[model samples]
Target chain A: MIPNTMKLFVGILRPEKFQLILASGIKYFAPPKNYDDIEIPERQRLRIYDKVPLYPSNLKPPKMQKRLRYMRGPELLHNKLQLKQYGVMATGGGRLRHEHFEMVRLQVARRLDMKRMFAIWRVDPPWQPVTKKGQGQRMGGGKGAIDHYVTPVKAGRIIFEVSGKCEYKEVYDMLRIIAERLPFKAIPVSQDIMEKMAADEKWQEENNLNKYTLKYIIQNNMGGCHRFISKYDHKWYGKYV
Target chain B: MSFIKKGLLQSPVPLMVAKRFRGKINVQKPRKPHFEKQLLIDISKPYYGPPKNSLPEITLCENINKKSYKREIDNPFERILAKECLDWFNTSKMVVFLHVNSISMEDKTPVFAALKKNDMHLRTYGKKIVSMATKGTRYEVINQLFTSHQNIIFGQPENAGKMFKILRKAPQLVVMGGIVEDRLISKNDLVEYSKLPSLDIVRSQLCSVLQSAGSCLVGQLNQNQQMLVSHLEKHIEIQNNPTNSDNLDTNAKSES
Candidate 1:
């Protein structure tokens, strides 16, 4: 049987829907939403971030290796939210510069209703030093001078979170903008959306009809594919880059 | 002489000489200045810049991702109170909104007592409760009056005159407006309505006015028959006694 709402649309188009109206069931309208539980925190805006990490004047800024592992495979830590409400989650691996941090900060500050909603950074500020040589210089003597800084992010890593009395719709646009502008693929997700995605992924895995799935193939190392793929592919079953 | 003349016109010579001497540096060692420690306040200021990409417009279909569920989060107490207030709206013939200033319990008690004595109730409800009670009802227009502390006096329309009398004694409760007999009226209109006489008295007065017109018509209709009877009786009296005819004739002349 058709819902009563459908007959309303049909009636609008036909204007003579007495027969259709007689066929439909009774309509019960949805009640309004209640926001009794949502408590706005003391502060309801993105916190200010330092341009660079604090370093003592006496000690020179420390240098480190490329550590390509940091940006490969899915993030094992900082993947879940500290204050779960809504946030931008990275879908691919990449590095975020200080400029990206400023972009996210400014966009959140501009759009967030400070009285009802607040946003916070989940990823650290730009702290990894990136080395670079002079523009026209030949091969660098020893290691090149440390130039700028960046924050390495991997798949499933939450870049920032917004919480408080606001619904996901209030911050969706701002989070989506930040996610799109990031170096790698990312998506805006609320806590419910994240949980649903996880449940769907598990359901798909459990209900797979195919005998030869990617996880199965990777785990069994069928056709000797281990030689061609990197250790990350073996570890994550080729799910994340 | 030329130098003296220039000095006289432009500058005082003795003062210029003093200025040149004053330019000499101090030869004595300067005293040590006191020092104070500086406090460094680290304020993490927000950075604003040109966004690399523009934000997409808010689309209507965005809520499709969210799962809808029935919310049963209404407060039970508020729900009951709202229902009770709705009953007040339905049953009462008049609802007068009064603005309550800052009044202590002692000052407020007498006003409440007076209203209670006259079969009127003075009630105060929160803005939320009032809005919930008035929502989608004929009494919804009174929702705007709930901006500040407000009291509602509910009673019959006839008792409005008595209500106004009691309210006049209490300076705290100022009648803003009210709904009387289902019609919304202002404070002045309410006062004017209260000044009107009771319904029964007005009805009786109208009945007397209506009956007087028919009574006057009946009196006019019987006047001709009554005059004929009186004239015949006087003629009989004159026929029985001829000596009394002169006295009767004088009476008839007066009558004519």
Candidate 2:
């Protein structure tokens, strides 16, 4: 039989009352809600334009004289490094509009899980602002109000890089579809293809074909007379011409 | 009357017992809180140390007749550059050399920037190839080249082909080497190289071949078991039906 004093003590310290005190203490000291638990607002997802936009007319596009001619050619230097497993290169040169870029972005994003796999834009979207006069207005008195801005793409420019937890073969057709939608002649190229092309070019020149080839003459259109004297030919002899 | 008297007596005793217990029990005393001094550690300071050497000492030969030269890569940074080249060469099955002649610095800037950006992207996927302007002596010794022209080397055979396609577009840069299959190939050979499928495609093709072979063996092994099971079922059917066995005996007798 239990002592009368002990029985009285046990009766005072009931399990239910002790548990209630512990719960209240824990409620007071529990860590604040985790940062990751905070819910993002729906309004933040909406697109918002910048407060002030720059005028495209005010800025000057770099004079790309020599570079412009090579735009339609294979990308020579830029994007030479195989930064991604799969990439889309613009084979044909033309102006790329904002809508076109957005469409391509949406198409790629829809196909690829944007979380595991993502794309890096090689070309910048047109940020220059172009204002226009009313449609019925007559021809320009001063410079006509600027039309919409555009990004001028030369051939051989890499459009975008797709990478991360994605296989090249799986994304090949998807990328091809995106390339078809692009205004310029765009093609899907992997790191291997690019490297092979570079190697072939190097091999040709090493054998002296690049220095004295009929293809060079036909491509450059230096008729038979100027075939020997290329524009790159240096005048080793003193200028006694 | 006795039951009512017992209940009334018990209730009064409990009340007196509770009063007596309250007097005997001592309440718990509150503890004084103790504060500890906090130690603040600074982690923002950057650590500095001597540069690490990354390049391995190896002899790269240019041709059969030509003697192999030992390249002098003295600086730690130079070793890093050499190491990058070596890494690309060893990892890639194909390596390419290019001679960029007469392009002005202004024009080269954008090209360099693009190459650098692409390099960063490639590094992420472990397909990155290094492209650095050849410092005549240093690069030539390492790459086993004879040209004095401004050159660039793209390493990693898997990616070397793609770089080849892009390089082909630049009519100005002359390709100097196409190393593969343990021998140097001529310009015409590059066209053949370009026609080949990428490494991933080849790997997938090989995997499919192996998978088909495995599946064929599994099917062959399963064929005998299936035949045996069917034979056993036919035998059991004959044993179960006496009329079918008698019909079979009559057919055999008629044939004879």
Candidate 3:
């Protein structure tokens, strides 16, 4: 059957050249990858996050201080990956506004292959209320009204996690776009990448040639440095504000 | 005189202007530096030396050649598997390490079955098991081949030729390197080794060469004595026939 088709094409191309076409059928195809263990969750897409927390109408909204400590220092609890997959982690501290949350959701939803992959939030939705004065309000006013809400994120905090049958390369671009757009420094990391980063940090600490570390100096109060540094600096060794 | 001039010049100009216009003002002030601050700066300077507890460099590139399958060795099963690997390493005269690329189940089954038929057993041990078994042993050099997916084929040295023949059919299993007769051999050396004659045949050939050398030496040692005996026989013959000796003399002179 192919020879008859080849005869027609002979005027345009040689029949011997078509021999490779027939030979192409004998290719050794690699075995299909096994995804038997991948149990995709019912919700294969990122869940929608609330723009604002539902507060009781009768109660007056509570005002709070700057409480910058919430966004300072490294995240100790949520620093590790729970799902053991790919995610975006903050390298510095900042607030995640409701707009940033929506932006991340939209980007992930648009790029995610929902059939094989699912994304889950690691950080909570916007809950911390940020107050601001009106544009032309007088400075003598007692206090400003609650303007908007934000989620305080700290260094080493994993923003969100993506897991399922997909690989790190598949979700890296989506995570990277989110990381780059965040108000603070952030990076995309997979499980192994995160593990390696931790290992490298441990290795550096173990192999540090300098005998005097920041922790060592603060602990010993060398040169009465405690008088110059803040209490937070004493706690975090000036690693964070 | 300076006080009189100050009182006289207390005229129209303001006190600020008078102070600004003052001439020959003293500019120098006493310096009281903070020695503690200087001490802090001195201590802040980084002094680097070798770490007190220096360890091996952390690296991933060094183990890239071998595809490793890492497994925890704390389990009792892993210990048994490690022991088995040690036994395989010690008992087998030929141990061939192969890098297994992705091969379909159909292809892999046949290749494994063929190897099994030739009395060659193929084993796949995790990197942890291999390290545990090969540590402090001569087979430790082969630990480099445990990087990724590796198959170790164990058999007698004489069956190396058959193993190579069966392995040739499956291109997915690349022959990396192996130990043949307690000696490490590369891929090319393995091929050469497989082509070599069997041990019995080589032993017979060596015996034949030795026997031939002995016979040649015996022949060489008897050559001068045999020539001398032939000359004595010729002299006896010459005495027995003097008339014949004269004719023989003329022939011997011509021959000489």
Judging by DockQ against the true structure, name the best candidate: 3
CAPRI docking class of candidate 1: incorrect
Summarize candidate 2's per-residue lDDT along A199-232 as a digit string, tens digits.
Answer: 9767644644224243343345444423333232
Residue by residue across A31-83, what tens digits does model 1's lDDT show? 54566676777766667667778999998998877765678778888888777
lDDT for each residue of candidate 2 in B172-235, tens digit (9 for 90 to 100) = 6567666564456755676567677887898999999999999999999999999999999999
Per-residue lDDT of candidate 3, residues B119-157 (tens digit):
899887767679888999988888887764468999998
Each candidate's DockQ score against the native complex? 0.01, 0.01, 0.07
Tell me how candidate 3 scores on lDDT.
0.81
State the weakest 10-residue window (summed lDDT) of model 2 chain A.
Answer: A232-241
Clashing pairs in 3: B66-B147, B66-B148, B67-B147, B67-B148, B68-B147, B68-B148
| Docking class for candidate 2 | incorrect
Candidate with top lDDT is 3
Q: Which ranges in model 1 have alpha carbons more than 4 Å from their true place?
A: A1-39, B1-256
Two-way DockQ contest, 1 vs 3, winner? 3
Judging by lDDT, tell me the better candidate of 2 and 3: 3
In model 3 chain B, which range of ten residues has the least summed lDDT? B21-30
Q: Identify the leading candidate in terms of TM-score.
A: 3
Model 1 chain A: ten consecutive residues of lowest lDDT? A19-28
What i-RMS does every model get?
28.2, 40.8, 13.9
Candidate lDDT values, in order? 0.77, 0.54, 0.81
Residue B206 in candidate 2, Cα distance off native in Å: 64
The stretch of ten residues in a row with the least summed lDDT in candidate 3 chain A is A20-29
